[model samples]
Target: SLFRILGELWPIFGGNVSKPKLTDMFYIPQKPYLTVGTLRDQVIYPQTREEYDELHDSDAGLAELFALVRCSNIVEREGGWDAVNDWIEVLSGGEKQQIAMARLIYHKPKYAIMDECTSAISIDLEGFMYVHCKKIGINLITVSHRPSLWMYHEYLLKFDGRGGWEFGPMVLPEGYQQGTA
Candidate 1:
């Protein structure tokens, strides 16, 4: 499975090396065609030929898988490797939320359904994720009460105080339009 491949190669690709257990969160592909070292060699530059050869020789297949997983932002945080090792069992709600989002994106799904997935993240990170999704051209269905979330959405589905709903393309709030004019 893709997840298993990612799990095996994650350490080689400079991923959250401390959290070996957490590697399972990635979605594994059905067939094993690539390795961690191959991916690392393809995407990142090794300081020396010796380094590349070492990675290439060390379970090359898994190395490729890890390289792909390492591409996720959540896996590349400063001190993230140490954090995953020390706090894997005691991660905060926000950390867990971020992990789940990373797993979802690892597979590059055609469509995503996010039910308040960003509730635990700061507004800035939430905005960043939305922008990333847009750049990737992934269709998203996000559900959240935060007004700021609407800024990243192309359409809005609002539920009125009454037992009614309104659906339409998103419009800039009146305040924003007034300032521009």
Candidate 2:
């Protein structure tokens, strides 16, 4: 029954989505799914190529954001901002995560839902990123197993996978000393 329904719907959706004639009017609403790994794409790809070119052409603090993520050298190493169009091919996993964090910082959303966003990032850099996020007033709802992240968050939510869960103020592990500024 489901296959029959899908087979009927496929003809309708498939033609419109797979190939549209020049004059055919078709619109498909798409909801973007962005995760920690795809953050670099968010920063690199705008709604249009013109917007991306304009962003680099203009003094819109792109350099500062890159510096914030320790990616300033990437532009220089890659020959220029133009080279960043192929970030996925050129950047390392850690670098990609950094770029994603930078994108989050750039948008400055009031509340960010981050799931293991900094898993590839080093503890020192992760701390720096968290500090800046707090400084910029972006609240983080982070999902990570790393105990190093406790100092940055005010609350904790833990799921035991066996239908058990806990939520409360962040509890640091033993001998964890948050350093003074």
Candidate 3:
């Protein structure tokens, strides 16, 4: 069914989405799936080349976001954001996840559902993402088995994998130590 739907909707995503002729490629009235293929594409996703050009003839703050993710060496190594390549081929797992987090922060959605999105990120940087999202007033319904992640949420909901579940206020796991500033 999914393939059939995507096929029917292919006109919207057919060929190069950058072509202005495809603008009339059937209206869906809502956000559709978007790909995060490149560093720049991740930041300004769903926007075609012309759309992004409308926002900037120059570069954006990708360097700063990279630094925040503790993965700032990309821009210098690749020459700049303009140095496009198959990021999936070049980047490590953690680097890819870091880029994903940067995109979430850039989008600043009101709510987010992170399903093991931080699996490859380091614990420290993972916590940084949580804190940053909280600071930006974004709520996260994170899906992780990392006990340390519980501290960031207001509630905990656990499923029994049956027709049952438990939901309540946050419960810090045992031996959890708050890092001193």
> Among these predicted structures, which one has the highest TM-score?
3
TM-score of candidate 3 to 2 decimals: 0.73
> In model 1, which regions exceed 4 Å deviation?
1-89, 161-163, 176-181
Looking at candidate 1, the ten consecutive residues that score lowest on lDDT are: 27-36
**57-169 per-residue lDDT for model 1 (tens digits):** 54344333334333344334523322224333444556555544544554445555566676876776767666676666766666677776777778987777676889999
lDDT of each: 0.49, 0.61, 0.65
Shift of residue 35 alpha carbon in model 2, Å: 13
Candidate 1 Cα lDDT to native: 0.49
For the record, the alpha-carbon RMSD of candidate 1 to the native fold, in angstroms, is 14.1
Comparing 1 with 2 on TM-score, the higher-scoring candidate is: 2
CA RMSD for every model? Answer: 14.1, 11.0, 9.3
Best candidate, lDDT: 3
Clashes of 1: 20
Better of 2 and 3 by lDDT: 3
lDDT of 2 by residue, 1-181 (tens): 1122222323443433342231221111111223322223445433344665555665246678888877777667766544435455657777777767766676676666566777887788888888998898877666677777889998877778887888899878789977532
